[model samples]
Target chain A: MKDVFKPEFVKLELEATTREEVLRELVDLLPVGDDKKELIYQRLLERENLGTTGIGKGIAIPHSRTLALKDVFVIVGRSKKGVDFNALDGKPVHLFFLIVAPPYDPKNRYLITLGKIAEISRELTRKKEWMEIEKKEEFVKFLNGLLREKK
Target chain B: MNKQLLFLISLQELDILIKEKEKEEEMGFPIKPCEELKKAREKIIEKIDAHLMRRYERLSERYGNPVVPVVDGICQGCYMLLPTSLISQKAKNERIHTCPNCGRFLYWVDD
Candidate 1:
C-alpha cells in the first residue's frame, strides 16, 4: 500500500460536481501520459457503466484493469460537496478511491487492494473523521491509519 | 487512429471486462453474467478484419490478452522490446501492428 498510496495522488477537496467529472479528475492524478490517461478514463467509465462501483457509505471505488497501466495505481479524492454516484444506498459520494491495474496481475494485487479499499470504506462508514483532514498529507496518513487498522 | 484499430482497442477492453466478471462469478462472487457486454462483443466481431480476428483468437486462446498497449517501445503483452520502426510511428495507432515476440495486437499507450 505504501508504494501505491502517495501524497501526490491525494486531493483534499475535489472540484468535480458530477460522477463523470470526478472520474476524470481522479485520472489526472495518475503519473501517466495523456494517451494512457484517456485509456484509463475510458476503462473506468466502462467499468462504471457495467455496474456502479459506488459501493455506498459516502465512498466509491472506481477501478479497472487496462493494458495501458504498467502496474497498480491508487488515487484518493475527497469532495466537500458530494456528488451523486448512483450509489448502492442512494447516497451522494464524498470520497473516492480509484484503482487502476495492468491486465497481467500475477499476485492478484488489484483484487487484494480492492478488498482492502472495500474494507476501509466500511470502516469509513463508522466515522466522519476523515472529513476533518484538510491536507492531502493528512488524508494519506488517515488512510494509512485505516489500512493499519485492518491488520 | 484508424477505425478498425479503434474498434480493436474497444474490443480488447470488452473482452477483459467479460473475462474478469466471468472469473469472479466462477469464484462464487455474486456477479451475474453480463449479457449486454457479450452482445457488444458480437457486434464488434462483425466489424473486424477476418485475418486480424483469426490472429487475435489464436493469441487469446494461448494467453487471455490478444490486444495490449505499447509503452516506451515495449509490448505489455510479452514485455519485450518492440522494433524501432514500429515504435517510431508518429501517428499513434494509425496502423495495425503485432509484436514480433508475442504476436499480440499493439496500440500505442503513449504519444
Candidate 2:
C-alpha cells in the first residue's frame, strides 16, 4: 500500500470544483492514454451511480473494479476548498482516495487497501492531521507512520 | 476516436453499467434510470450494424462481456495469448475483431 501512493501521483492541491472534475483530475494522474483515461472515468462514474463513495469525515474513496486496470493503483488528491461529492454525511469532501484495480484481482487486494485507507482516514480525522498536511511527502510519511503503528 | 470505436466503447460502458445496476438491485438498493438507460442502450444497439449487434448480444449472453480490451497482445477477457500478427493488424485497423480463442470482440488500448 505504501508503494501504491507514489509522490508523483499525489496532488497536494486540487483545482477541481465538482465531483466529476475531481475524478477526472485524479484519473489524469494515472499512466494511461486518452481512451483508457476516458474508460476509467466512465467506470468511476458508474461506481458513483451505485452509491456515493464519499464515506464522510471530509474523505471520499472513489473507486472502480474494472477490466481497464492492469493492477491496483492509488491516487490521492487534496482540495483545500472542498467539493460537493454527495457524501453520506451531506458534507463537502476534501480528501480523495481514487482507487483503480483489475476486475479479477486475485487476492481482492483492493478491498484490503481500501480498508487501510479508511482506517488511516478515521485516525487522521480524529487528530485533524489530514487538514494540516501541506506537502506530498508529509502526507506519504504520515500515512506510512500510521500503517507502521497499526501493525 | 473513430466512430466504430466510439460506438463499441459506449456499448461496453452501457453494458457494464447495466450489470452494476442489476447487482445493486440484488443487494436491495433500487437503481435509478435503469429503464431509461436500457431504452437508450437499445437505441445504440440499433445504431450498430444489425449483424454485428446480434453477434455481440449472443456472445454477451454467453460470456457476460462480448467486448474486451486487448492488453499487450493478450485477451484480457480470456487471458489467451493472441497472435502478434493479429495484434499488429488490429492496431492498424480500428474495426472490431474477435479473439480466436474466446470469440469475444476485442479493442486495443494503451497499457
Candidate 3:
C-alpha cells in the first residue's frame, strides 16, 4: 500500500454529537464489510473503555485494530462547535483523526501512522490557524496541504 | 554508582544544605559557608531540574505520560488500541505510529 494520505479520507461537515457517535460514524464510512465492521467497532469501544482518548487542546484521534483489514484507513473529522470529550484539559474537542489497521502485519505500519499523526498534531497544536478553521472543507484542505508539504 | 541511590543522596544533601544555610543566616553569622552551600545547591538543582523538565515535555509529546506501555495493541497512556491501518503501516516502517483515539505517540515495548 502507498504511504500517501489522501483527502478522501477526510470527512467534512461531521454531525456527530458525541465522541462515541463520531467513532461509530467514522467506522461506518470505511470500506470494510459487515463481518469486519463489528470487530472493528468492538475494538474501538474496548480501547475507549480503557481511558479517555482526549489528548487535550481540542483534538482526539480514535483508533482501533482488527484482523479483517488488508490496509490502513484514516478518517478526519472537524466539529466547529466542539464536542465534550472529557479531555484532560476539560475542554471541548474540535478535531479528530480516526485510524484503522489490520492485525498481524509484519512491518508495524501502525507505529508509522502514529508518528505521522504526532508530527502533524504537534504542528497543528502550535499554530493558531488550525483553531480558527471552522469549515470542514478548509480543514481537509489544510490537512492535505500539510501532507503535501511533508514531501 | 546506582542511579537511584545517587538521585536520593543528591536530594537529601540538598535539603540538609538548605536547612543549614537557613540556620546560619538566622544567627547573623558571616554567611560565607551558607553562600557556598547555596551555590552548590543551585548547581545540582539546575541539572536535575532541567533533566526532569525535558523528560516530562517529551513524555507529554509522546504518550502524554512519562512512561507508556502498549498492551495488546492498546496504549496504556490513553488506552486506545491504535488504528489497524496505522499498525500495518508502522509494521512496514513506513511511518511512526500513534493512537488515533488519544493522539499520543505509540511505541511497541517488549516487556
Candidate 4:
C-alpha cells in the first residue's frame, strides 16, 4: 500500500486552475493507455457530478472504481494556489489525492486505501500541513509516518 | 493496444453513461438531457467493426454490460476463466477478442 503513493506520483506543484484541469492532470499520471485514461477521466468526472469528492479543509480525495485499471493506484498532486473543487466546505483544495481501482478487484483493497487517504487528509487539513509543504519528500515522509503510526 | 481496442473502450464508457442516465430516470431523479451520450455512442459504434458492434448490441440487450476487463485471464463480467490460447502472449492483437463464456468484449489489464 505504501508503494502505491510513491514520491514519483506526488506532484509538488499542480498547475491546473480549474477542477476539471486538475482532474485531467492527475489522471495523466496514471500508466494506462490513452483509451483507458480517457475512460478513467470520464468516470472521475461522473463521480464528481454525483457530489464533490473534496472531503473539505483544503483536501480532496477523488476516486473511482473502473474497468480501465487492474491495480489500485494513487496519484497525489498539490496546488499551491488552491483550486475550487466544489469541496464540502466550499473551500479551494490544495492537496489532491486521486485514487483509481479496477471494478472487479477480488479483494476490494482500494476501499481500504481510500479510507486511509481520507484519514490522512483530515490530519493534514487539521494541522494545515498542506500550506507548509516546502518539499515533496517532506509531505511524503509525513504521510508515510502517519500511515506507519496507524499500523 | 490497437485503435480498435481504444474504440471499444470508448464505446464501453459511453454505454455505461447511457445506462447510468437511464437508471437515474428510472429512479425518478431529476436528470438533464443525455443527448451528448447518445451522440457519443453513435460515433463510437460507427468507428468499430460492424460485426463486433452487432455482437455488442446483442449482448448489451441481453445483459446490462457488453464489455468487461480481463484480470489474470479471468473475465470480470462472468467470472469465468478464459482459455489459455486466447490469453497467450503470442496471440495476435489484430482482431478484437470476447469472452467465450459470456460473450462480452474483453480488454486486458496488464499489471
Q: What is the TM-score of chain B alone in each candidate?
A: 0.83, 0.80, 0.35, 0.77
* Best-fitting candidate, scored by lDDT: 1
RMSD of each: 2.6, 3.9, 18.6, 5.7
Task: Name model 4 segments beyond 4 Å from true.
Answer: A1-4, B1-67, B71-97, B102-104
lDDT of 1: 0.81
Shift in Å, residue A73, candidate 1: 1.3
Per-candidate Cα lDDT values, in order, are 0.81, 0.76, 0.57, 0.75
Candidate 1 per-residue lDDT, tens place, B2-108, comes to 67877777788788777678554433233335777788788988999999888888988998788887877888789999888777768867788888999988877
CAPRI accuracy category, model 3: incorrect
Best by DockQ: 1
* Per-residue accuracy of model 4 over B1-111 as CA lDDT, tens digit each: 566766776666556545555543342223336765566567778888888778877987888678787777898899899998888855334457888999888877662
Tens-digit lDDT string for candidate 1 (A40-129): 898788778777888777888888888777789899999978999988788999999999888767898987787777777888989899
TM-score of predicted chain B, candidate 1: 0.83
Residue A115 in model 3: shift from native, Å?
Answer: 1.6
Tell me the TM-score that candidate 3 gets on chain A alone. Answer: 0.82
Q: At residue B43, give the lDDT of candidate 1.
A: 90
Which candidate leads the pack in TM-score? 1
Q: Which is the winner by lDDT between candidate 1 and candidate 4? A: 1
Q: Whole-model lDDT, candidate 4? A: 0.75
Ranking by lDDT: 1, 2, 4, 3
lDDT of 3 at B6: 29
Question: TM-score-based ranking, best first?
Answer: 1, 2, 4, 3
Comparing 2 and 4 by DockQ, which wins? 2
For candidate 1, list the clashing residue pairs, or say none.
Answer: none
Q: What TM-score fits each model?
A: 0.88, 0.77, 0.52, 0.69
